[model samples]
Target: MGEDHMERLIEGHKRFLAEVFPGRKSQFHLLAETQAPEWLFITCSDSRVLPDLILGTGPGDLFITRNAGNVVPLTSQDVDGCTATIEYAVEVLRVKHAILCGHSDCGAMKAALDRAGLDALPKARRWLQHVEAAFAHRQPVNSAEGESAELASLIRGNVVAQLWNLKAQPSVVRAVDEGRLTVHGWYYDILSGRIEEYDEELRKFVVLGE
Candidate 1:
């Protein structure tokens, strides 16, 4: 069954090479020369968490970092791929906006809740500790909003926690301090197909602006 899926993927690649790539060949060549991506998008490693497809963004438009839970780790000494990528994006790539996006029905958040499932993967269990900060940062739960208020709060909390982690990044901190970068926290709802942004001053989640 997986072989069939692989065959389909190969066929799709052939189509891109034959059709899509030919038309966009020159554009791709130029991109290969230099990439001036404007946004640093931090999202989950989930197959469904495709920022480009959802945001209508192209390769040169975004610098992305993906991980299980879209986590941004603090505690400066512990270095990892996500932080390294973020540092490069902020300091070298000079992306103007850094966005930390979390989603509904996240398996990572569910794992955090369950705890037991994470025990087997010691590294992952330790990594998820970073998300605990999300609890304090989460906005007040809206009971009217469908689903468990507790779960929603945790999800929202993760966004806030990761956003803080994003800010604490040295590169992000320097860029923001220089007034050259803006940071954002977003929650994407799979069921509704809508995104909500965290408003720092308002301390609430609002539908993204037009």
Candidate 2:
């Protein structure tokens, strides 16, 4: 880490210690020993994204895994950190719900959609192969929202694609069959600060809480 970057993070930690930590000290102590997080949060690795800040979740409430496109590869035999964490969350932690969330204006999705631009980034181009399924899963684009809708629709499609991949994981498959778990797909629109949940039964996206 850069010295300047470390200094900024330390300064932020100081603020957290002074302002945010005191109010939640008692809760923090219990979490220090053990954590029984109930939710698994899967999202993109975006600088502006913070799950706890957006969802108002406390430290131990969520187990999170972030990646370039929040892509979950079903065919890979190689051990991926995201899959390993998800397996632990399902099998060990026994988390009851797993939320796969994708966001608007996602660089990954945009890159996946525009392949020619990524010709130079061989690794990233290869990594995004996981999202090819998103095109088939895309929601009917909303014309009213213009360009924003196109991106949001694609982002939501990624959530759907990844959720299916997540369900294909052995641990997650068994957990759901046992009725010990539920998987959710979410579209988080940063500009609007609105969260829409994918209704698996309805095959539609609806604003959270009706």
* Model 1 regions more than 4 Å off: 144-146
What tens-digit string does per-residue lDDT give for candidate 1 at 1-210?
A: 599989999999999999899888888999998999999999988887779888999869989999988898888476799999999999888999999999888888888888999878998898788788877875676687676777888999899889988898888889999999999999998878789999999888999983
lDDT for 92 in candidate 1 is 89
TM-score quality measure for candidate 1: 0.94
Best by lDDT: 2
**lDDT (tens digit, per residue) of candidate 2 on 1-210:** 499989999999999999999999999998999999999999999987789999999789999999999888877668888899999999999999999988878999999878998999998998899999998888865566535666768888888889899999999999999999999998887877888898888887889879
- How many backbone clashes does every candidate have? 0, 0
Q: After best superposition, candidate 2 residue 106: deviation in angstroms?
A: 0.5
User: What overall lDDT, based on C-alpha atoms, would model 1 receive against the true structure?
Assistant: 0.88
